[model samples]
Target: MSNNKRVRLSISQKIDLLDQNATGQLNQTDLGEWAMKKFNLDQPLAQQTISNILKNAETLYSNVNVVKNSKSLKTTRYPQLDDEVEKFVADMNNSNLPVNRDSILRYVRHIAQVKCRIPGKEISFSSGWLTKLFKRIGVRSRPMHGESASVDISSENIQNELRKIEELLEPYDPVDIMNFDETGLYYQQPPRRTICSESLGGLKKSKTRLTVGLLCNSDGSYKGHPVVIGQHKSPKCFKTRANLLSMTAIGKKHEVVYHYSTNAWMTNEIFTAYVKKLDVAFGRQNRRIALLLDNASVHKIKIPLNNIKLIFLPANTTSKLQALDAGIIANFKAHFRAQQYDRALCLYISKKLDNLDVYKMDQAQAMFFLANAWLKVNPETIKNCWQHTKILAFKEKTICDFEPVEYPTSALPLEEEIVAELNGMIPDLPGNFNNEVTDVSQLNLEADESDMIVCYTANTTNNEETAEG
Candidate 1:
């Protein structure tokens, strides 16, 4: 003569029940009764329900991030297949292979047909299945490219190095712990491909490159002046305007430090000078910084400095350890490319440039765009990259909040009407435009034996010249 209602507990509530049951003070029936009363259920939970919850305690505990109202953990139809595919995706991604929705779909379909081999029936996977698979695997679509893929950094080694880094970084605030790294800037490279009026007009990839060194603190509150190294000490483009090559001309607004090398590569002398300047600047501000850098030969300079303690990452681990490589550089490149695209579109609109001419830019324009791009990189993006490296001391319970680095399609000339109007005109875009273009290439600035000898000879020559003077 009693009316009672069945109730499903949330994942969090189930975890609490498991914790209470773990005390070993109550039997299943007692625990069920206790849970019903504690959770204000209409009826005591069934003994079998309590037993099942306890049996899946580990799963419930792991799913604490599920929505508060979520009452069930749904199982996939093919858990084994899902697991294998997930692992495959992880392996491909770790190796830096291009794996996108189409690739994943092809992979899953191949597995189903060849491995599953269900008689007479073709297992079909839809967008829903792919979406679910990505959700279950806890990954999002990302554009991965560059030399980072070539470096195979072991997770175990990264963990060990992180532990050491954490201890060293403990004394400093997040805002005070800084990381610096350089990336090659293919400044003039256009999108690998773009919609044109005629058949796709692709151009040879631009080899015009500059090496840019970026530095930022863990909190991203402070961004150091970017160092832009190009092959020309005073490129012909800068000569058009007086004082154009000087940092003073670009002025305090951009705050970029311009340098030059024969090949636009970072060298020991350049890095030493850069750090010495930073050390002096920090000293002036009465600030002490624990600067994290990769163990590159160029970074091994013996610079007598105050207010800066240099912390080098373990060799070959920069791919996983360096903060800039995490996503900040990629983000910077995205912004830079967006601005580049904007310039092209503007020129095309103003009738100042024709199809292929739209992509053409002078070194001076490239420098201004690069400086603006550096300024445009979000501080939040910088902070997220630092956290993503996990070089800081913390148990990051959840996945990193960084969105996948993507080319800013908004800046691309992708307006349907515009693309439709230009349908047949041939515009030379960047080569390989089909694939995602992200710059994660942190070239090893380590000097080879020959390069080291050259650097040493150069330094000796410079010192002797100074002495003679």
Candidate 2:
């Protein structure tokens, strides 16, 4: 069978191609090779096809819509306004603020009245406009309830909580003030979007996950060993020494403490045991530290520790008040995802893997990468996240004083290298390469067990009893 395959280029890709062509850095043939590799085409793009695209480059550029990750070009009524609103919504979501129809409409009104003010002219934001805005931004209204719905995200309430945490943490040294939280890790998942045919786009995402608990000091000087929880105790990948050594060779020594539960989630028992272990460690060092915790039911401490003081943040306020939730965990996940791609690429280079279509990382492999990722998180990043919570005493700084920080993600150095190496070695890619992504704050929130399920075969259940206990 021929390895060559046909693919369709989206309007965005076409515009990007035009930009590269305009650079005059590559000839038609070379550009064809670049396009083949870039778009994951099985065969080199024909010279005539490039010429035709270049001929219609202006049309393609004009058709490119403001909607992000859109595979199709759209005719938007207000392109510039759409871009601004999308950016506003994204910033709101990234800051862990609620983004609902009311909030969006308020923003639209602000932009129309303040930013785009015109004498004797008023802009009406109709339901049709709101619907189109939501569609363009890929946002939908989801039901919110319980404590989350009742969360007082008002400025006064948030400031009061911040002041309260600041006061509680004031007496303790930065190193003695610590925050602990749990996050979900989808280790084997790929990116959510990919350059692919219509048939392959919008496929279901992988639900395989492990819960990771991270403890870090306020000063960013100390990152305690991670506590990992998974569905299985003795997974098949962990059955052999060789499998463990493979991960060790790729990353630093694995120091992660692993546990197992029925659903691989953080339970009251697991959290209490983990805390007790930390308390004992601190006691041995003669350290009396303040441990900050969220109001999760699992975070309840059944036993009192002599050396540890547990302070729980206000209900539904961890997103704004917890240091780790501010950005530390997101940065850690970025590093983890980057290492994930790095591991897959290394395997492919070693001929152990055939393609990048699907790279399955076992529990053992995930542990090593998890350790490495946590280790790679910068101390400054941790401090910055702590500052972000406004729970720490930080000097007033203007926005212009700091350059925007780029959190590490899978796309950063590895994606380009993988594409370049694969283009040279392999002529055909089996399937679309997904770049899995999700909300960083959502990872730290309590997981919905309904979406996650782990199944092991009879042969791989050897150490299940011992692991679970």
Candidate 3:
């Protein structure tokens, strides 16, 4: 008779077999017989092992406990490396430089080799290590394309300045308080992506842009017409007799006024003309008015006007303290882009139906679209923007109860659906086309040419002379 040798089962193998048998389809005797035949164990030994496994089955199934002490060499832990990386990150953030994955990896490798004195062969800063490092440091990497350099809005100096402005504004009526700012529009550029053919490599868009100045009262009761500045004194596109006549007629009908300059920028001369218009509109009113502006060179005009006061916001505080920057400009741009998208879709559909090869927009059309967008901005949006800059404090009582203004349907676009459809139809769309305009509204309450405002307390002669002069 051949001798049968018993097989020794490993702990993992034993656990696996026990787990399989734990289903309770077979009784203990049957399981023991099966183990004896399959694992080449003696009947008595199999029965004993099976009993022990069943008894300890609860502990085995409940916990994995996979980690085991090893006698082999282990990697060294560098606790100091974390502190060094944190310091490096702090220095990078403070330097106002872009911090991206590649830059971070390069920084870590440098530190590991030079600062930590780790030999090149021994140093390893894999992507996994970088990920873990970022997690431990509690920092996330993201695209911050247009974010302003960090400002200490809560600093003592900023608080004191805000307090001073608050005291200065206490006496003015909400209607008499206003924020003035300017923005630029790239009117011809459709959002980077639109319904287009995937086969096309790229689409080159027109670079034509226009600058606009916007003013609105703190209570949203009044919004000044947009003052549009364009590059051509008489654009060739508008030189046609019919086009010129149409432009003239449109200017007369709309609140938006068009101006021309070499660069389409708001110069002091153009700004002076705008202030004159503001003077005619609001300066004649008996009530004192306070206009908040940023410290832009163009806003420094010397021309004096009657019954108006200019308050220059603290330096670099425009992002935090300027009401227009808080949301008004952003809303305007969003509305403008939505209008453009609608126009493009309409034109595309019309061309397709007519079998036309192409469709394009002219300056006149862009200006009209801009005017319509300006009008579409909700009055409530303007009022809420003031709240961001604390211009309209929650505790302050207004002349009338705040009524919510209804936003037009045109201002609300189904952004996700529109974008997805556009991308599907036109895969060649530029990725960055929908980015908000980055033009800073460079405005200052102080005019370089004149004080722009005649003090309410000044002598009548001085006020009259300043206004007349």
Candidate 4:
């Protein structure tokens, strides 16, 4: 009977309380008067509030009735398969005697594809195909994580940087250590793509979704514009490879800089040409590069491959502990989302929502819109977004999920290679979130800045709590 209590109420409990009190004998006037006395409500406010509440009670009741009706309306009747379809089912049943998930999906997808091809699209299997398949066949597929990328990270190079930074940090200020990395931005990349197993889903493509990679700094600054790659009709090997290699350069003119050549920054000529470009981007200085690298095998080709002094981040840590992730990538993803939405809207206005058509709308115009929006964003804004974005936590008793990662075993001068888990101390979160954080950053990367330090974490499995489809 008492509404006044220190405890919080669950949604259902609050609704039940409203029903119990509102449906009781008191009229609105009495209800307001009673509330004022019983619940310590202000006199005038109570009267107006209770008046509005009473008027809306019928609408709330209507909502409850609608929910109840929908829940109770249940029917299960298998629509008889056509004679031809029936024969197929009979053959499968007679041959196998048991239905499997893969077979079910194969059959269903084949049927759905055929039906979809028919014009007017009148042929629908069921609105419940997703739910039905999930229930009957079940989705065991999941998004890829850290180890899916082979680690060519040169531990020797990293150890060398660690030795140098450990000496530097032991005496100097940590803020001076600059940590930087490159991350992909999904512009046309279906920020919301349907995922399936890499092997079985011959139906799925890797670079199918458009993606752009960015070179990022530890303090949350980017050197140049993110490579604005678009989606391919179907994913191409070299195109995906090229797009990933993309990252804006930094140096005095042209000098070997970061650890690995990206989809963007690779040297077409000898390594010195790239170094000369880096020199132009970053003036020659005593700055050591703190690198957070994927353990891809090809990374071992450094020194012989090029000439940038470097430090390597610990294995399996970029997304977990990298300040860029904490500061930039997480925020960038959110900012990029809104950016994409606005960009999409703008392109739609011109009756050209296609990626390529919109791309031609003037690099100046595109930069103008993004710069206007970007000016409003900053590191704090992005860091705050990182606080809310869902991350898949690792769930290991020991470290079984951690595989033996290879360092630089050995490598030729010019081979190319390209780019985890937890849980239960706390409930796992959805591995990703499109938080409404709109903050853009003002930080800029100074090539003359000191050697940067970066850290990140990766696990074998990500929990489903924060998992998004």
State TM-scores per candidate: 0.57, 0.53, 0.54, 0.35
lDDT of 3 by residue, 11-62 (tens): 4556666866868787777876676676566752356667777787666555
The global C-alpha lDDT for each of the candidates, from Candidate 1 onward, is 0.77, 0.74, 0.69, 0.39
Ranking by lDDT: 1, 2, 3, 4
Over the full model, what C-alpha lDDT does candidate 4 score relative to the true structure? 0.39
Candidate 4 to truth, TM: 0.35
- Rank candidates, TM-score, best first: 1, 3, 2, 4
Query: lDDT per residue, candidate 1, 342-362, as tens digits?
Result: 988998899997777787787
Clashes of 1: 13
Summarize candidate 2's per-residue lDDT along 52-142 as a digit string, tens digits: 8888877677766545456556566556667778899789766757788878888887876676663324446778878877887677776
Supply candidate 2's per-residue lDDT for 289.
Answer: 92
Pick out the ten consecutive residues of candidate 3 with the lowest summed lDDT. Answer: 66-75
Per-model root-mean-square deviation over C-alphas: 29.8, 26.6, 28.0, 25.3
Top candidate (TM-score)? 1
What is the clash count for each candidate, in the order shown? Answer: 13, 6, 12, 73
Off by over 4 Å in 2: 1-164, 196-199, 202-204, 242-253, 347-351, 354-357, 394-469
